[model samples]
Target: MSSDEIALSPSSLAETLRAGERVRVLDVRNRDESDQWPLGGGDVETTHLPYMKFVQAQAKDEIGDLAAEFDDGERVVVICGRGESSATVAEALREHGLDAVNLEDGMRGWARAYHAEELDADADGATVIQYQRPASGCLAYLVVSGDEAAVIDPLRTFADRYVEDARDRAAELRYALDTHVHADHVSGVREVADRSDAVRVVPEGATDRGLAFDAELVGDSDELTVGDATLEAMHVPGHTTEMTAYRVGKVLIDGDLLFSESVARPDLERGDDGAEEMARQLHRTLHERVLALPDETVVAPGHYGDDADPEEDGTYTATLGELRDRLDALSMEEDAFVDYALSAMPPRPNNFEEIIETNLGRGSVDDDEAFELELGPNNCAATAD
Candidate 1:
């Protein structure tokens, strides 16, 4: 079969999955790698079959195992580390009359296709829209109140979409804020600011990060007001000394300070020297400052890892009571908390340095180059073990 007929673009594949259509995803990675970081989204069914085994069961150099697992003409998307190997596998599967297609650019291509799900509705004063970059679990928020809106921790590749979101909501874009100088995807703060007339806001503590652009700095007690929405900035200096979480009514834009399922790693920006100190700061930030908030307060954090599933209500959120009851990180004593926080972490996200530079306005890349630099899921959390 020709390459054109046997290849599925990531866009088309994402659409199929989002539409709740049945499409079997055959991942040809080694079994261990799949176990370590499984590919999952919503309810999509994925199967792991190492490349060698897949070809070994083929009769007379033709695919038989896949045919046995799936009916003839069943749609399947084959994926490997890079885009190349999957094409070969798709070609092999097609010889057996299955409608197999190679996933374009493989997993990396899939990572760049971000989709948003609105988190707040029908409640009271304001609303929040969550942009979930499913693969990396990097989340951006569109917090709206009356006629004004705030775009926080926007992903670099999807900045314009946020501006469009503001327009769609019939709100004037008032502020573009970053939780901290991100070490994952590029920050779209400048993109949001440049696209509209919004002001840029960063943490007062970001002086250490040496951001190049001018911005209003907010620290604990300093608040940002947009119409009836008053977001109080809380200086929670753990993940980064500069990371800020905004208090909007019951919602805390918790940044990287806390996650609904796990805690942020402390070693990324500090390297090895300041691991202990960073962990201590993180502990205090969670215990002394953040834990003081009301138990009913809802936390909306910056990034999420692979296993987090949004609630059936379509919101990725948790109350202080829920997190306090469920989150293991909250129960640790000072020393254990520090030790756990300083433990081994996953490898940094791809092009993390470049992403920080761009976010700081000290570096630039073309759109294509930016997307290439940010082609995979963000490894922004610590390893479970």
Candidate 2:
């Protein structure tokens, strides 16, 4: 088969997985890399066989034997770090009479496999599109009303996707907003602004974190209009001192302040020295600012955990009342909440410091470098009971 015919694009794989078609994946990346962030999807089974094993088997004239191990009736999709080695392995397996296909661009491509789900909730006459990055479980949003659109918490890797999506809907992209200076991935606020005539907006509290970019700073209770819809900025600092949430109709474009399965980790910005204080602030934000909304307010967080099941409509969202009842930390006292927020924290995101510098406009990386930097799980959430 031709190389093109022997390869499956990440989007195709995503569609297959989303459709719940049974798929078998042969991951050929190193053990550590595979263990750190493995491919995941509904009804997809994965088997890990390091790429070096295939190379050694081929060198020993045992490629046939190696391929025989994966000779099940199902077609296997081979994946590697960048897809090149996996393509070769897939071709070798095909020569051995096995149906094998390489995952185009491999895990990096998988990281870029972004899916957009239309939120089935009221947005004050606006259409809400939730952009889900499965590889990292990062979520961004696009809100369109009348003729204007705004994108929140966009990733630099898919900046153009947001612009194209907005234009496809016959709407002018008016605003590119970020909840705060992101530590997990490079922010696309600048890229979106550069691509369109959109104004860049960041929380005014971010200025305290040495924000050097030129953006319209929004303070507490600040409002911006998209067509006929109003986006009111709520300064709800917790994950970081600059974290903010935007309320549009009944939906809140809440950044790392909350998630479906966990709350935001408070140490990313200030580390251990200030984690306690930040945790307390986060508690206040949850009780006073976030949970203060009506029970039916749709809380759309910026990220979702691996175990977080999406709603029937495929959006990772929960009502304020639901989260208040579901998360134990939300119901805890101030001291208990702080202890829960700081206990059993996961490792910080890969290359977070550098990503933060890039997002802050204090450093720069080429497009390829930026993509490579944020390739792992976004360990942005704290452990929640």
Candidate 3:
């Protein structure tokens, strides 16, 4: 079991995953940990084998069952919560004549491997940068128009990186915006604004949430300038009462109000009783506010999950027409759609209350606490199918 270092960094593993390499990831965390923070995607296959079970098998010296599952020739990688347990498991697996290497830094490392890529905006004068937090299903954007720019739904942890990207694009940071009162991740709008003298704009209804700190509040048809381009605000609720989508040229920077596969759930702030009412509002917002737009308009959502719209660079986006055609569920009758939303509501994201408080500036937590609250892919997309 003793040997020199045998580990794969998250980035190296990500490269292999992206290239469609036939790598098998053996996640050696317990059931609860694996369920809460599952890994392994792209072209990599994952098998859950708890380290404790593997250790017990090693103690018994009857490795037949364990040995039969994995091929000796295939590239097998071991991962734990943070790589400590996986190293031991890898060592044990190696003793059984299997080529297994521990994943360096494990799931924590995976969380930080957010690949920020530029999105090709058919909007003539605008440059949109998509900050894809692959581990958490969070998508933030930096929209640059001429020399001015707007920052949207940014994470608090990556504030500096967003600023640096703005400088790299040579766009003067002018506006910092939050689509709504986020219930998952802390907003970077405050930091982004403080660093660049950018005016922070929250959706008009957000003021009703009793949030203390604020700058500008925007509502329907309210125009905000981004250099040569204009971003008109659309009051699209149902995710939250405050949900607003910004129309930048032909692109709808839709908030949690709409996603690629599913629309936002109605019961987070409302609970079950108010869900019906919220669902009705959602119907109006989509049928009246959002779907009323031209089919050519591009929908850039607040986040994306596994079944998101596919693209060459792993960016999640779709044209209104494409989605309207593909997602037949979106076109359901009003009564059916409301019933569907209420009935199909999934479990809320972990620590949503604390996350919402932090976003509202009513509660405060350090970086580590914030990270813990916002871990795993966002469950905000209602009925992920």
Candidate 4:
């Protein structure tokens, strides 16, 4: 909270970066913790270091090597869930005779302070794709084709930028909607679609209550070619009956059905029903369908929220070849995966109902209204299992 003081608060760290100061973000949380809840991207350069591991142990032995990675006198801002762990790391770095500043309030405070940015607009060429890293743990995308682009879960006002990006890319923005629905920040799919002349496209089997659209009612293996890429619709129902995965080339746009590597939480919609359903579906999909693809295919998933393991973010982009070799669901018998999934799930966010309604054009709020409600990055959701 202090400015002149050498130590920095997360809010102040944000302010300093805004002022064009160079700061290095050092995360000291454990590998698993970082995976579930990471610090979202913003105005600073961040380097991750799991607490008391090879990276940390080596920091002392190679202070010069570590210091060489940074500019002379660059303020090193270390962080973790609470300030204590980061503070300790900073002290060690400082004692090693390097200029470093511990980030006060740490990761939690950072999530509370800085806002996420929309990096690429018109991301998927003429289709107009926009990317958002919201609530530290969640990643949402909006893509448009012609006068119609689909919005998967949206995180911030970044939705507006997504629309603008579509315009810049010379596409007529039409439809906005999520893959199934969401449990994190209220989905702004409809909020954004309404901002333009777009309709909302709910997956064919999802709940429908008279929403207007160029209804793209699809079934298993049905594919839609938007812009230059083809998004194949795979009806892999486990996380939810309506849950679908959109595949383009080797890249699978796996909504909550698949994460960087792990399948998404199934407990939200089904509760106890979810655990059994997810396990069964996961076994079939992973062993028979997904893993059946070429090992080199790339995988991009939906819902990387507060529950993801941060240490795995870089490696999150796993190849079909790699995923097949490493997937736990594949090795486990169906019953085991069901039990494991139930035990691993975090509580779904308290705002899922609101998010679903909002995405379905039933909620009462604008994009700005929803963005303000989700300023802090918290993307953890516990489903029905």
TM-score winner, 1 or 4? 1
Order of quality (lDDT): 2, 3, 1, 4
Worst 10 residues of 1 by lDDT: 34-43
Q: For residue 262, what is the lDDT in candidate 3?
A: 84
Off by over 4 Å in 3: 1-4, 18-23, 40-44, 62-65
Runs of candidate 2 with Cα error greater than 4 angstroms are: none
Best by TM-score: 2
- lDDT of all predictions: 0.78, 0.91, 0.81, 0.57
Clashing pairs in 3: none
lDDT of 2 by residue, 253-362 (tens): 99998998889999999989999999999999999988889999999999987678789888999998888888888899999999999999988999999999999899
> 206-243 in candidate 1: lDDT tens per residue?
77787788888887889888768787888888888888
Candidate number that wins on TM-score, 1 or 3: 3
TM-score of each: 0.86, 0.95, 0.93, 0.63
lDDT of 4 by residue, 1-385 (tens): 2322446866665455434455567777777666555554435466777777625566558755655665467677777776877776677677666667776766545644523333221134433232424334455554555554555555444557657766776765555645665655666555566677756555776654333334455667876656565567777766666767766555566666666446666666666655677657766776677777677666656645422332232322456666556666557777777676667565455456665566555666765566545534343322322
Q: Which candidate leads the pack in lDDT? A: 2
Candidate 1 deviant stretches above 4 angstroms: 1-24, 28-38, 42-60, 65-75, 80-88, 121-124
Sort the candidates on TM-score, descending order: 2, 3, 1, 4
Tell me model 3's lDDT, rounded to 2 decimals: 0.81
